[model samples]
Target: MPETIWWKTGTVYQVYPRSFQDTNGDGVGDLPGITARLEHLAWLGVDAVWISPFYRSPMADFGYDVADYRAVDPLFGTLEDFDALIAEAHRRKLKVILDFVPNHSSIAHPWFVESRASRENPKRDWYLWRDPAPDGGPPNNWLSNFGGPAWTRDEASGQYYYHAFLAEQPDLNWRNPEVRAAMHDVLRFWLERGVDGFRVDVIWHLIKDEGFRDNPQNPDFAPHQPGINRFSQVYSCDRPEVIEVISGMRAVLREFGERVLIGEIYLPVERLVTYYGPDLEAADLPFNFQLLETPWQADAVAALVAEYEAALPEGGWPNWVLGNHDRPRIAARVGDAQARVAAMLLLTLRGTPTLYYGDEIGLGHVPIPPDRVQDPWERNEPGHGRDPVRTPMQWDDSRHAGFSAVEPWLPQTEDAERRNVDAMRDDSRSILTLYRRLLSLRRDHPALSVGGWRSVPLPPSLATEVFAYERFEGDETLRILLNFGSAERSIPLEDDAAKQETWSVLLSTRPGRAGEATGNVLHLSPDEGVVLRAHPSS
Candidate 1:
């Protein structure tokens, strides 16, 4: 078996703080709630728990906007609560990763407050600020990701400041040496507290073009897309200088030893791979989101996997994400039946996998009433809100899905009564059980964890709807088959082992299928996925 590292071989579970669990009945989850629920993650078999930001903030962007990088928000808990949570999580052998927001800060941050106070302030250059155009309008044609112009007028300073998302969240001037040093200090602070790593938010947007040039219009821009897509962000983000900044962060992490750095990058595989840095020193994992953008068909997904696998630089570790707080759940995106198949695909792929908090029990999107809508993006662009995916986690069939005594900050899924950890843990056919089984397999088999992988060729007729691959370590080989279609299919094994090998079903998404034996031709039910171990006929 190859040398293994915790980040390379372990799965990461994302815990969205506000919606995970509420210990104080504040309708919002806090540090204590997460600490209390550490047992659940340990029981679920994930290797690490990545908690979204609990830093002090005004919640303009739901904790993405940081106010105090060093302190936990009062709403989440005090610094002591965070310390206790870390201690408990470490005691359980679960690595803790914090969401480190480096791109922007809330307008209320002391640095931003001082920057906006006056153009002549000592910290005035801490954020991106520019003079108005000759026409007395905004500085540039840049558009905010949330809606209008990326530049917001600071009437007090009589200067326009840039904000990539909301006006209340201003982009920091990363070119400033002081800003970079301060952000680096934030990473050291958490590292000192024993955090296993950080998921660096918008790491690609750290440095912008020095010339303040306007982004050219995207010729393929469509009306249905967000306004920010109207122009390609060539100058606004992903500048070449950003790599050095990341390398600096990597240097700081190396000081702490074995600390992982995960960057939240949304670029194409070509650009995304560059974040790995020279000799793989920058981002340990740039977070692959190809599964989110690809068409949910067997052939399309298969091609995506092959492409991502080919794109990785030599020795550069790969990672995969199926669902997150920002996107629609996999169950909603591909429907419930195929979600089980997706779980198999995500967990068995040749990389690290990130599981969204409620995905283990198959939580789909919950409809948000207009009165209950909370995502600021929805206010900026109607119908584009992410509230549906960011709802409270369904723990049980209790009031507020056992998430809170009072109403949850967001509503629960429609099927929370039946689709919860407590309800699914005992159900053999439930998605949660399937997840646990798969996780256990990963733990028990080196072939499933730190193994070499190769695509398994299927017959042309089955290739369009049946995707197959093999994970092998030394003498152990495991084959994974996924049926993306709704019709029953039989896949023929064409390999020349005298055509008399017996395949044992180690695990199957469909219930009552494990321990079943199959001949050269393997059968599959609609939307079913199975992991098979081939035993040569004696």
Candidate 2:
């Protein structure tokens, strides 16, 4: 039998620190707030919590622009508060993974501050900087992901610095051995603090092409798309040298045994899998966001899952992400009913699953009033703001949804009055209940966790709307059936199992479906998902 790995099989729950919970009535969540809410995660049955950035920062791009890697931001708490968070999480048998932003640092960081001081400063080469073009324009045609030219001129020094996101966040020169060493120490600092692992932010952007070339224009660029899409980012991101940097980070985690490295790479599956490196030396799990990008159709999703499964390197574990701090919620993307199916699909899949905070309770996008907007991207590129999905978590119907005594930094969903953890916990058929059941099932069954996965072929009549797959290990076999369409459909299992054998419904999105017996043909309600346990008919 293969050795069981915690990160490979455990489920991950992402907590957007600023919005998760607030204990000090400061209108923002703190580390102590997270420690207080650990019971909710433990009761929900998740194996780990991946907390987003809480590092000391200037808040230009929120905590992603780090001013200090080792110190916890005062807005969140102190270093002692972080230590307490991990210690308490470990006490609850839940692992804690921190968001590690290595690609860039806040312009306020001492390192960047020193580097931008002067052209002849010893730290001048620590960040990407160049002289103006002959036309006195920015250094290159490379565009920032947050819109505008990637280069921000240092008015005092007359040199331009590059940033992939906000100008307040400067891209570090990964080619600099000192920078690499410094970032490596950052990992060691957390690992030594007993952090279970790290979710490396924008990991693919760690290294830029050495030639400092202009990114080619994207032929498919549209007027409505974000300006970054104007260029293909060929020379700006996912450079080959980034793999070596990933391996170095992986080596640091290796020094602290049993630690995991999860990289956030926004690329196609074929390109995404390469970060695993030869023999899996890079990220332990390069996050798989296919579910977030694919069309909400059975056929499209089926193909995506198959493509991702095929693209994984040998022995590389697979993972699925339904939502995150950066993307729209699943409920908003596919509607409430389909979001239930998404939960089933995520937890029942063969590898690790990351549950975005508030997703378990069916939180959707909340309309943000212009005056309340906090995300800098919205100010930079109107319409591309992620503030709607990064709102405060809905814990109850209390004022501020019980997240804080005062108003939160962001607004809560309009339906938070009834759609909250406290309310959902009392309702048997709530999306939150469905999530807990799915997670509980994963915990009780190896076939659902560290099992083998195979797609089940469906007949042409049901092929476009219904997706089915099997998870099996030893004598345990479970079949998952999902109906992505709005219309009810029936599918037969003749191709999957013997026609005479009956399958027992282990769990279903719809109430009263469990414990029911179904034969070769299974009837499914619209936008419903079911898990069936197969055994020989006595």
Candidate 3:
């Protein structure tokens, strides 16, 4: 068999370490916990596992605020534990992608501590620092994504440091060559240890507008939007210079051949495509967040998909995401019935699919009581908490949903007792079963995995509720139909010759319904999705 480049034609499952599993009875998940769970990933048949940050931190912004890049926090485990995880995952034929936070470092990081020690320190320029405006306010009108101002005054150093997130995460000055070189060394540290790739966090925010210009007020700002949206981020983020920084990081990956680089970027499709770099020299996959932010409507999502496909730069691959540690679960956003269709769409889409940890078992938003809230963003911003979505994974019906022996650091999903891996494993109608079937189909059929794609047009009456597409390689064409509405919809094959071609149901999101339709016009149930292959012409 020829060597296969898995990143281009495989799915990734995102594992938030602190919530994955706990083996030490410390109410927190650890590296050893992840190693023990590798078998589950292999069973699911994912190509790679993307582990979110597990580095040393002050727990201010969780692991996103990295204090030490090379060491795993004792709360997680020792370096030996991480090496064991890598070995186990590889032994099971799974690639490991580590979360890399190069945009910022925790205030407690030795580099940040040294940089803030004095104005004349050699490391002073490693972080962004500026004097306050004449009125003794922030140097600019920058805002944090979490909430409030992005700049915090440092009394000891008499300067205000800028952060794209919490003040605990000080933005690194990538313009400083020393800062760039230091981050490169961090990447090397892990690559030398046999890590496969990196999911770079907030990569678009690496370089800001050099002049420190005040962000202009947004004409469309609304009270319902987050405070960070009060001003457009033109000056504060997604700067043109950031691509050069991305290219430099890509060069480092080249040093370790076959290692992929996935960037966490939230810019517009046009701007997002630029990060691919000329000749595809930037990120191997700049994460596509369109599905996460777009309105959950059939026509709206269909247009977004086609638009994204049209915008891809030559030789650049596409990726998709519905939820992650930062966003709400899809089941909560689209309801349970529609989540099934989403599963079909994600698995059959024309690019890499990233599955959030608990999404497979239909985990929804779990409320976090005031005292149990661990996310600092939630503590600082009352209504905008992410703690609800970062709950523990539900493994069984045991206490804490079998994620830990004691209460978890955060709450598990409200229905985890009934909806968990153990409960769904044996049920053919469960969402987990649908996911397993979809993954298996993708593995068995090339038309569904690496085939060419074309959008199948629907009548105007069914346009808003239905999305139809087809993928074909040679004579094999797989037609996919999804109903986003609550009412059933019937779709007729458009072409006369193609319509006459007999078809068989390969799978359906609705269980016990496969192999039911054998006619030209396919009947679809409410919130249903199905995949069919045209029989060879006799």
- State TM-scores per candidate: 0.98, 0.98, 0.98
Angstrom error of the Cα, residue 262, model 1: value is 0.4
Q: Model 1 scores what on Cα lDDT?
A: 0.91
* Order of quality (TM-score): 2, 1, 3
lDDT of candidates 1 onward, in order:
0.91, 0.91, 0.89
True-structure RMSD, every candidate:
1.3, 1.2, 1.6
Q: Scored by Cα lDDT, where does model 3 land?
A: 0.89
Q: Which of the numbered candidates is closest to the native, going by highest lDDT? A: 2
lDDT at residue 84 of model 3 (Cα atoms): 94
Model 1 vs truth, CA RMSD: 1.3
Candidate 3 clash pair list: none
Q: Model 1 — which ten-residue stretch has the worst lDDT?
A: 493-502
Summarize candidate 2's per-residue lDDT along 68-125 as a digit string, tens digits. Answer: 9999999999998998898999999999999999999999999998998888888889
Ranking by lDDT: 2, 1, 3
